[model samples]
Target: MTDVRVLIVGGGLAGCTVAKMLEDEGRGGDVLIVDRDPQAPYDRPPLTKAFLGPKDRMVQSPPWAPADVPWLADCAVAVDLLARAVQLASGRVLRAQTLVLAAGSLARDLPGRDNRVLTLRTVSDALRVREIRSGGAGCFLVEGAGPLGMELASTLADDGASVTVVDPASAPMERLLGGALATEVASWAAEAGVRLRLDTKVVHAVPVGDRHAVEAVFSDGEAEAFDCMITAVGSVPAPMMLHGSRGAVGAAVVDDMRRLVDVDGSHFEGVFAVGDLAFHRDADRSLVRSESWTAAKNDGEAVGRQILGLPAAAEAVPYFWTRQFGRMVQVLGAIPLGAEVVPIAVVPKTGGMLYQASIDGSTVGFVGVNAQRLVAMLQMQGGAVAEWVAPEV
Candidate 1:
């Protein structure tokens, strides 16, 4: 069995962040990363936004991850937590002093669809979508109106493709933007010529004779045909490799130090889990399960420091953003379900708005649509803001 100081299971943003940090601290030589995708550890947000454009070049290698660092392009099949060992599908065994689980997530796709029903997860998936579009799949059906679906639909619509977004939810991004803000977003989407079919879901799907186009039947008893259908329903934690380990792996329990908790309620010594799959405890002592890219990056930093026995840094506010239909929507902090959203100000002609998400009169979060400057200012102020008044014409 080969031995190392640290063994990382996934090579996504979280995995790369941990390695980059350790490398910065001169511990890079002791780390080894095993992942299924050789082109992984790259930024994924770009895969949906500004990706399908003709002028856009796929970012093959992000500068954040160094190629000099040691890594293996192989899938991890099992983990032995008691011995801090990992078994790869290639029949190789690696034991480390510390184990980092950053296996990311698995995209959920519709069951009754053919190979044309794509889900955007990796750069390859995005490339396939692009290829099909180039091959004349002009009409696109994006199932699910979450951030992924909305972003993909926007991207396709921007590329001159007829796009229809269907979801069972009442409004777009209602989970994060709440009622008013989400409705505003939906309005913008509609104005941009995107077809938003809310309160609707695909109940049946079948491929056309060509196998590229799909005929889908919605819950509203309406049937439509599209050249392409993409599912952005959502993803679940992919800690399947750790399932073979000693304890419960998918539990939403991790210490503030980013250490993975064992089934016995004690954190596995030097074992950490981060990114999409793992649940983390924030500074407020509340357990938060986030699929945010920012959270994964933050987890990498915290886990790195903890490994080095350094003092943990101050917890950062969870931040996420989506650029769709030439507008940027950003979320800072947490937006609880059914929270109240209050508009702070609106730009005179640009249709920009800054909103505050409140729970019981306290600003729990901020939602900014095309208000980058104002949002940056409020973020710099540590979420405290003066009364914002829109400038008059």
Candidate 2:
């Protein structure tokens, strides 16, 4: 068995970022990254955006220099935390002084894993979807109304496919954006000609005939056939590698320092959990697992700094944005459910709207539609809402 100073189990944004940070701090030779995908790591956000469009829109991360850091194109099938060793699918065993679990997550599968159903979570998945679009598949049915579903639906519609988005949520992204913003987004989606079937679900999907289509059965016993079906029902953390380890690996528990917590709620030395697999206990004692790109990057960087014996950077406010229906929707901070959503500004000429979200008379967050500049300014000048003034629109 080969041994190294550090072993990172994923090569996605979080894992690669950690490797780069470590190398930049003059620890390149001590790190090894193992990823199941043989291809070099690339940015994933564009997969749902530009990469699905024109042929020239290629989305790839900047190439890593020094090329000497070992990146094993293998999957970690099991882990022995007590012995600090990981077993790969190819039967190779690796041990490390410190283990970083950044395995990321997989796209949640649909109810029916039929041949006609697809989900976009990787480069290969995106390519397969692009191929389907190029093949002139019409009448696309998208399951789930999350950001991925909406983005993919818009992309498919742009590609000349009649698209329909069905979700069991009362409104698209209601749990995340609250009812007001969700209703606004639903209206925007309708104006874009993409049909929204709110509070609806697909019971099952089955292949109809030789045309490579799927007939989806709804909750109301209504059946509809489409040339293709894409499910974006979110993702679940990929932490199976840490399972069945006799309480040595705790994939679901993490402390503020990103260290893996044992079954007894104690931190495990030299074992860190970051990215989607990390369930961080906030100051409020609530466990939060953020799946956004920014959150993953911050998690990796913070853990890397901690490993290097450097002072951890101050945590930045959580941020997420998406492009859909010819507008940019951005959210800053966590807007809890039942929060008071007050319209702060609305500019029809610039197609911008800003809402101040409060809880019990205290500002908690801000949601903006096509108001990136305002949101960024507010984030930079962080303070209570009492002193802030909404721009006259």
Candidate 3:
């Protein structure tokens, strides 16, 4: 009889974490990891902040890895669910008892955007950005105020280039951080000498003489131009492989514990899903699909526990952070529905702000800038904000 195995697709954070855990558990037999990139898995966070370096280089390995594990450096082409096999782009087939998808996502370029634009999703993309920006002070414009775009903006500004960040929203990070913290971030951007263009939209981009410029017509009909454009709008799951698979929803399907694949509901058979791809048809699906790395890593660990037939671990606080203009901002836990925002504290010396988001008089979440240690401290004390009103600092 052929031995059963595990096949993990997309060697991003989730896939690699799961593979390493399986290997450590002596389940490495017949385990295979397939990914499109040839290089060993490395830290993607450095692709933005660290590479902008006064003292940055590729550095060393991250916290996780199983040195002897088997991996195939090929993109997955198809999932033969019936045969329990994964098909690679090179026409190779590998059978497994379990298949995991951590294929991740690609940036969602605007309607008229093309290859002339740059993205920061992978290590190679980051290297290209460094090479182009390092040539000298070049005009840089970043679209969106999310983590990737904001970090890139900070990197460029620190290198002595005039940077302009344009977003269609009224404030820099309202969607993720709420209005109070967003205003604080906008203030920090101005103080750090980064140009801000809010409620702005791009109309068209064209090459002019020796340089490229995008003719952007903002919502107010003000036209603007920029030499280089970078986008960090967001990402969608790379779900092409699940188009014809049974029991799949869009790019992936999830179970009660948020595993990725479709298991037999009746018999409770084995299957799993993780990362950005996990979803449910319930009311909160939209927010559950944030696609951030923090979400992906937590889902990865959850699925690992499930494979071992252990009870699912408690869901994490669901956090994500960005370092821009040397200020650290993070969002922890779910944003309460119709929550009113209140200012907790703002340190003028460091430009860090802490705000509590409350709904129906209960603190549901908090957004902090340069206050990660403080935020963790708050969460550790039985959800600190709930215990008492803010004491004057």
lDDT of each residue in 160-279, candidate 2, tens digit only: 679999999887876567655777887887877899998889998989877558998999789999988888988888745664335545455788788887776766678887888788
Report lDDT (CA) for all predictions. 0.80, 0.80, 0.68
Clashes of each: 0, 0, 5
Model 1 per-residue lDDT tens digits across residues 1-393:
999889988888888888988898888898898888877767888889856753245566776675667989998777776678888889999898999988888888666766868888877888889889988888999998889999998888888899999999888876666654666778778877899999989998878867568899999999999998999988877645554245545563677677777766677777888888687666776766788888888988888888787898877776888888889998887786788878777866678888887777776788888888777776665423223232322
Give the local distance difference test score of model 3: 0.68
Q: For model 1, what is the alpha-carbon lDDT of residue 11? A: 89
| Model 1 poorest ten-residue lDDT run | 384-393
| Collision pairs in model 1 | none
Q: Write the per-residue lDDT of candidate 3 for residues 1-393, one digit (tens) a residue.
A: 222477777777787778777777888765677778776577677777866663235434566655667877887766655456666778777767877777777777787776666777776777666777776537877888766777778888887777888887776766676544566677777776788887776666554436444555566667666667788787776654642334543446676665544344321234466666555444654535656678778777777777767787666666777777777777776664356777688757676667788878887677777776667676565533456344333
Q: Name the best candidate (by TM-score).
A: 2
The list of candidate 2 runs beyond 4 A from truth reads: 54-59, 63-68, 243-245, 248-250, 282-286, 347-349, 382-393
